[model samples]
Target: MLKEFREFISRGNVIDLAVGIIIGAAFTGIVNSLVNDVLMPPLGFIMGGIDFSSYFINLSGGDYASLKAAQDAGATTINYGLFVNAVIKFFIVSVSVFILVKQVNRLHRREQAKPSAPPAQEVLLREIRDLLRDGAPPRVIPAADSRTV
Candidate 1:
């Protein structure tokens, strides 16, 4: 059982998957920051300076200035702005992953496009075959006159 576990941990695929998961977690943090801090601000400004982070409807009878205020006052609210932000984040991450995969595929295709070297033995055999095919025909001597006069 211990040996099996060790083998599983030692496998290249498992190690690669672990590394990928760690990198993906880090990438997610960056994408989330980009969405929340950088992208959303400009997007909100372009939409008539409306702050998307605060765009929500208070379910309770009383009105609140922001989602936090509504939540603090124990009011049920539909946080549509947060949902929109999440959707935008999803699109950003999806597009980035798509581009990365496309580039990797392009690189893979380029690697495959290179021609392989021919085998030395095969090359030599082909040369010999070509020589035989293009060689002059053999002349036949007469049966009675063996020597050339």
Candidate 2:
């Protein structure tokens, strides 16, 4: 069982999967930061400084200045601002992955489009066959000349 486990762990596919998982985790962090820090700020600024992070629907019949304040006051609230941020993050990740897959597919198609050379033996045989077909004439060994050699 241990040997089988070792073999499974040593496989190239397993290593590639591990590396991909680590990279994906790091990429998620970057996309989250981009959505929350970079994109949202400018978007909020353009929309009359309306901070989306504080936009929430109070369900407890009391007005609160911010989401935190509402939560602190034990108010039931629908945190739509956080939901908006999540949606933006999902969109960015989706577009990025789509573009990446598209480029990878393009590269794969280019590789498939390239013509590969034939094997050396096949090429040599083709050349010899062509020579026999078009470049050579049949040698006529006259019956009378056969005895002279």
Candidate 3:
């Protein structure tokens, strides 16, 4: 069982998955920072300093100045501002991934589009086909034993 487990862990797919997971985790942190720190601040400034995260519906019938204040008071709240931030983050990540996948797919298409040399048998057959199309006399291809039909 240990040997089987070792073999599974040693596979390239497992290593690639591990690396991908780590990178994804790091990317999520960066996206979160970008959304919360970089984007929201400028947006808040434009909107007269009303932070999006503070746009919440307090269900506890308590008028709180901010989402944090309400939450600190243990109020039941619908945190729509935080939801908006999350939506923005999701959009950014999804678009980035879509662009990456699109580029990779384009590269694959380019590789597939490139014509490769035909096999020797196909080359010979093409020659024969071209000759026949040019109205040349049909000649039998000689076999391995030098016999022609």
Candidate 4:
């Protein structure tokens, strides 16, 4: 059972999945940063300085100046700003993944679409086989003549 487990873990698919998971975790951090640090400030400014993280409903019926204050006061609140940030993060990550997949697919298609020349040996062998099957040597025709004489 231990050997089987080891073998399963050593498999290409398992290793690939592990790497993908690690990369995805790191990518999530980058997406979060992009949303929080880069995208949100300008967007918030454009929206009359409304911080999405501060947009919350106080369920405890307490007037709080900010989400941090509400949380510090132990008030139950629906934090919609955090949700908006999360949505933005998700969108950025999805777009990046989509672009990556699209480029990878395009490269795969290009590789598949390229026509490969047959090996010289194979071409030579085919010509010899055809000559033998037809019981004739290759006849060279003059460029001026259209008819096979």
lDDT of each: 0.89, 0.92, 0.94, 0.92
Tens digit of lDDT per residue, candidate 3, span 1-149? 99999999999999999999999999999999999999999989998997888899989998999888999999999999989999999999999999999999999999999999999999999998999899999878765764644
Q: For each predicted model, how many residue pairs clash, with residues at least 3 apart or on different chains?
A: 0, 0, 0, 1
**Which of 1 and 2 is the better model by lDDT?**
2
Clashing residue pairs, candidate 1? Answer: none
Per-residue error at 6 for model 3, in Å?
Answer: 1.5
How does model 2 score by TM-score? Answer: 0.77
Query: What's the lDDT of the predicted structure labeled candidate 3?
Result: 0.94
- Which candidate do you rate higher for TM-score, 1 or 4? 1
**What's each prediction's TM-score?**
0.78, 0.77, 0.81, 0.77
Report the C-alpha lDDT of model 2 over 1-149, residue by residue, as the tens digit.
99999999999999999999999999999998898789999999999897787889999999888899999999999999989988998999899999999999999999999999989999999987988899687666667765686
User: Residue by residue across 23-84, what tens digits does model 1's lDDT show?
Assistant: 99999999999998899889889988877879898878897877898999999889999899
Error of 2 at 21 (Å): 1.6
Which has the greatest lDDT? 3
Ordered by lDDT, highest first, the candidates read 3, 4, 2, 1
How much does each candidate deviate from the true structure in C-alpha RMSD? 7.6, 6.4, 4.2, 9.0
